[model samples]
Target chain A: MIDMLTNILQTTVLYSTPLILAAMGGLFSERSGVVNIGLEGLMTMGAFIAAITSLSTGNPWIGLIAAMIAGVILALPHAVAAITFKADQVVIGVAINFLALGLSVYLVKFMYDAGQTPTVQKKLEAVAIPGLSKIPILGPSIFQASPFTYIAIVVVILSYIILYKTTFGMRLRAVGEHPHAAETAGISVIAMRYTAVLISGALAAIGGACLSISIGSEFNQGTVAGQGFIALAALIFGKWNPFGALGAATFFGFAVALSLMGQLIGLSKYVPSEVLSMLPYVLTIIALASFVGRAVAPSALGKPFEKGSR
Target chain B: MSQLNKQSTIVTALISIFLAMIIGSIAMQVAGYNPFAAYQALFVGSLFQAFDLGETIRTTTPLILTGLAVAIAFRTGLFNIGVEGQMIVAQLASLLVGIKLNLPPVLHMIVAVLVGGIAGAIWGFIPGFLKAVRGVNEVIICIMMNFIALYLSNVLVRNWLSEQGTDSTPKIPESASLRVDFLSEMFDSSRVHLGIIIALIMAFVMYILLWKTKRGYELRAVGYNPSAAEYAGINVKRNIILSMVISGFFAGLAGAGELLGTQGYMAIQSAFTGIGFDGIAVALLGANTPIGVILAALLFGVLTYGSQNMEHVAQVPPELIRVVVAAIIFFVAANISGILLGAVKKKRRAKES
Candidate 1:
């Protein structure tokens, strides 16, 4: 029983990687007062572009970079509209999601000669650190994971430093919390917020690339599979803190892993895989119902930054 | 026109869209497809072809409801991202009831649609309650609800409902199904149905309620300035919950339009069809006004239908349509923001003047 639990935990770590990355991206955007409903779209776009890049260059690193670029590019519209245009951030975010899914799928059909990319043989190889992998059972599980898993951990620390510690972080948080006050302080609220949102796009793209090259090694139309929403949940559950979000991501990862384990153990053979697949979503709802934590988002979170508001 | 001194906002919007179009066209051309052909196909397929046009109206039915859902919530100052989830939950409820109940056509239809709408209201109300009572952000809560709805639907379908509890459910009774095909025979064998009429009526009704009714005024006032509204003796929280519930009612209808009016059955695929999310764009493009939602929904309907044809015939990636929609939304949002900014600038100038 212990071994079974341990093995399931390993799969959970793998499953949660993309979500942790995406949630961290969302934290950057939301912390800066931009509601990034576009996370899903950016992730999807990243997945498609990453697939293309990996296939083209036959290198996962290139795919990761390419996915980031694509994500930022997709997020450009949201930034321009929400920040520059001062449109409703939520609406712009929604449009980004739709545009991302539609554009990527349309491109795949046009470019790939099929709705899916050809499955590639070359994939990201998992590596284990010599000393760390042998530390213990937990050590083996943790160290013998993808490089991106470690990156996720590092980025969480980085996001915390960037969001709470640095001058730039101060400006981003200020703009989100009170753009008018931030403006008076000469923060260039618009500029800071735009930068935060763009960073969100870049990070979300990385998450998408991680999703494509790391696990699937191929991209399909709906590869994102609501991981973006899961990330959003993590952001909420974590109460906008990076470390908290990571823990939230892991919790969801466990939800996913447990469902897989549930079936493996024949815990509910009567239920189908699709039903099990919905478990994460069900957990998200139950989480909301329970009211996980106090969400004190930037005061001006959804307020369209209209220059004209009296 | 002069009274609207910021004709510049509209001009800016047009210019942005023009810029987006030129950019899209250039991108398409660079990708080796004739941009001219693509645009021609877009316009011709969307508006001119009888068959395509019919399909557009069919797609527009649920879109209008979803758009209204978003618009109503926005009017109350709530960003109801959970419309997708609410729509799903309501849809499942209607499907379940749709098969279980046996009644006359009118009563059955009312119960089927109304129950679904009520279910959506419950979903919307949860976030509304959170925002009102606890100060939780509706955006996050609604999103969470959407995920929950999706999963719950899957679980229910697989366990309790498939083949009487299968991945698929029994076909809705004929009495429960809306007569969506009454005009199909007249419309080139297209699926365009009476749901379009229902959507138009709902839009008109929404417009009247928002603009002409006392409750509408309260909802609008609360949306504009919640603190001021509370100070002025309005029950801000109640109004908010009411607004969200109203919007969810429409979202529920949107789901029913798909299940009962369009598909006449239920499937797990029915959940989170993006209509709830897409409705946000519709609400924004329409300016969250009732008339705006109707017009925007129709336009979206045209785009979707035309893209489907463009995909079948031209091998032009139908995704370009999504890019165009995104570009259009970007332009529209930018336009509104510009107007608001201009208003602020004018106020400052007025103070100076």
Candidate 2:
């Protein structure tokens, strides 16, 4: 039973890392006043580029960097359209998702003559922390994992600090809550929003890199598999707070792990795998419906700020 | 000025399409393919042949319904991303009714289609209710509901509805089928059915409902400004839910069209049909107008059906069609033509002053 518990805990962490990273990314963007429905596309770009770069360079770290850069590049058009042109953010987001799906598949087919890339030569490997890893359940679940797992945890902490404990974070929140006021206070709303969105892209890309390099070990059409949306849900469920998103993501990861465990334990005979797969989504709806009333959004979220406009 | 505004919108859509074609050509060139030949093959494959045109019409049938589905919701200020989910649920419901019913042919088909719409309404109602009552973001709720619907449908198909070795349900009885003898014969025995006529009628109904009815006025008013509409005595919450139900009703019809007109059976979908997602593009290109949806749906149908021949004759990847479609959407969403028109308007204003 202890062994089974440990195994499940390990799987949960593995599953939650990407969600945590992406949700944290979403937290930043939403808190800074922009609604980013393009996280999925950004992640897709990151996963594809990360896989290709890791395969060619034989360096996972280099691939991770490439993934972040690719994410930022993909986000540029969304930023330009949403911020500068003041296009509908949701429409731009949906279009970006479609574009990413098409572009990635086209690139994969072009490069590999197939719909997915070959397994990378260099993948982010598990690092067993020397002293901490020897501890029973907590150690194996938290300390002994991929470097990306540690990075994800650090990201959560850093996000908390950056969002709640810093001047930039305060200005970002101010901009999200009331861009006009932020501007009156001499804060550059556009620049703050741009920075926030760019950070979101970078973090979301790292999440994608974690998927291709650490979890899946290859880039396929399904590598991102609605995980980005799940992250978005976690963000909403967490009320757009970094630590809250981290906890929500971990909860979802636990649900996913439980589904996998059900298969292993022959629970499939009683409950279909498809039904099990519905758990996280169903929970998301319930959580949103139940918590959204209390969880207020940034007052100026999804609204475009024009200079000297009320 | 209203006429000019409409003309500018059309011009913008046309420009976006033109620019997308250029982008596609550039991509083809980079990929070492002949763009002109590929486009030529695409046109010929979809338009020149009678049978191919029939295939295009058949494909257009579902797109018309789904496009209207998204368009209606958009007009009501709701983003019904769960059209895909609602369609799947309705598809499954229609399949169940299609296979299980023992009524006369016409009544059975009507019943099956109605069941689909009702099932979709139920699916759509969840998120709508959540949004109306709980203030949950409809987009997130709809997105979640989509996954739930997908997984639930797959389970239902696999455990209860699956035929012997295949993952699909048994062929739906002829009584529930929408196939029409004369239509198929006219199309060189293609899978074309009466669903196209139904879709056209629905488009007309949509036009009448949106423009000629009080309920539609209420819906539109609520969509434009819910708080103001509420102050003006419209039931904003009710309209929000009603809009989603109506949207889901059409999405359900799209699913019925697929099952009755095209597939004839519910196969376990390994992935989303993408017709629902594509509906967003259709609605955007259509300017959320009923007549525009028909035209846009036809165009999308041609591109989808023609991509196969393009791949065969020109050796271009069919994925290029998707790339082109995405490019068009990018340009449209960014309102590239709107920007150009604004520039023009500004120059005119300066001269007038």
Candidate 3:
């Protein structure tokens, strides 16, 4: 029982790492009043770039950086369309997803002469903290994890600080809440939105890199499948708060961990594996409907800000 | 919301398509392929040969329905991303009905189709109900529901529907099948069936329903401006649910047509069929009209079926078609024609100054 508990906890944290990172990314963009439904695409680009770069350079760190850069590059069209062109953000997001999948898959086949990238030469390694490694059940699970887990935790804390404590954060929130009012106060709403969206792209891509480099060692069509949407769910369940999103991501991770490990732990005797596989998605719907209550979005969410119009 | 005139809408669509084609050519050049030859292969492969044309029509049939599914939702101010999931559930339902039911020939097919559509409506109703009553965002819920439907369908297929040692259900009964002998022979034994005729009929039905009916007027009003719709005494919640149900019904029918008309079995799928996702592109390109959806569906059908020929004949990857489609959607969403018009007007004013 103890061994199973430790295994579940460790795996849960592993699964949660990417979700936490992506949820934090989503929080920033949504807080800045741009509904970024393109996180999935951003993560796909990140995963593809991370694997390709890591394969070529034999350096996982460089791959991670490349992934972040790729995410920002991919997000440029979304930013231009949503902010400058004032296009429908949802439609732009859908287009982003299609473009990301198409471009990545096409390039992958072009470069590798295959549908998927080969495993990277170097992968991010798990690190075990010396002192914390001795703790009974918690030590191995919490102390030993991929570096992305630590990064995700740090991002959550940093997000909390940036969203609630800093002056820039205040202005960003103000812009999202009331762009006209923010403009009246001399804040550059467009700049804030652009910055937030770009940051979202970078962070979400890192989350994608976590999947390709940290957990898995390669990129494929399904490498970042649906995880980005799960992250979005986490952000919503977290009620757009930094720490709340982290907790929500962890819960989703736990659900996924349980589903994945249920067979290994001999729980599949009672439930079908397919049913187990559905746990996270079903839990999300239930959480959204009953537990999370009503999530109030940013006032300017999904709205194009006109300079002089209501 | 300012409605563009019909002429401008068509112009915008043409410009967007042209721009996307140019982008596709640039991408082909970057990838070391000849764009003209690749396009030629694609067009010829999908349209010129009888068998390929039949296959294109077969591929286009379900797309038309899914496109209509999405277009109706868009017209009613909803983004029905769950069409994919709804279709899956509907396929399962239709498969079961097609396999187990003992109804007579025509009745069995009708029953299977209706059951499939009803199943889809139920899937759609969840998100619609929540959005209508609880003020929830339908998009997120629809996405979540899609995953649930996918898993549920997989479980049902493997556990109950499939024959022993098989990953899919048994072939559906001939009574429930949509294949017609005459149509098959006309297309050189292609799988094209009655689904095309049904799809075209639905498109016209949808057009009449939206333009000539009072309920559709109310639905459109609610979509146009909910507050105004409420003030005008339209039941916004009911319309929301009704629109979703109607959209889901067609989504299910798309699945039924694919199964009963072509595949005739339910296989455990590892991933989405992508028809639903493509429906979004179709609706956008079609300008959310029935006639436009049919045209857009044909375009997508050509691209999808023709891409294989591009790969076989010109060594161009089939995935390039998706990039081309995405670029088209991007241009459409950005209203590239409007921007060009603005630029031209600015140049004229500069000359005057």
- Which numbered prediction scores highest in lDDT against the true structure? 3
What CAPRI grade goes to candidate 1? medium
Per-residue alpha-carbon lDDT of candidate 2 for residues A24-51, written as tens digits (9 for 90 to 100): 8888888988898888888888899999
Q: lDDT by residue for model 2 over B182-246, one digit each (tens)?
A: 99888888888888998999999999999999999998898788899999999888999999999
lDDT of 2: 0.87
* Candidate number achieving the greatest DockQ relative to the actual structure: 3
Top candidate when judged by TM-score against the true structure: 3
Q: Alpha-carbon error at A143 in model 1, in Å?
A: 0.9
True contacts kept of each: 0.68, 0.65, 0.70
lDDT of 3 by residue, A145-175 (tens): 8999989988988999998999999999998
How would you encode candidate 1's per-residue C-alpha lDDT over B1-353 as one tens digit per residue?
11113454345445545766776776577667777777778768877766667778888888899999998888887887888988888889889888888789878887888898899988988888877877666777787678778878877776777785356877898788776455776677777766677788889989899999999999999988899999999999999999988988899888877777777766666335777877876776666767767877887787777776666666578777777777777766667445656798999999998
lDDT of 3 by residue, B50-158 (tens): 8899999999998999999988888888889888998999998999899888999989998998898899899989989988988777888888888888889898898
DockQ value of candidate 2: 0.68
The parts of candidate 2 lying over 4 Å away from their true place are B1-7, B344-353
Q: Which residue runs does candidate 3 get wrong by more than 4 Å?
A: A291-295, B1-7, B349-353
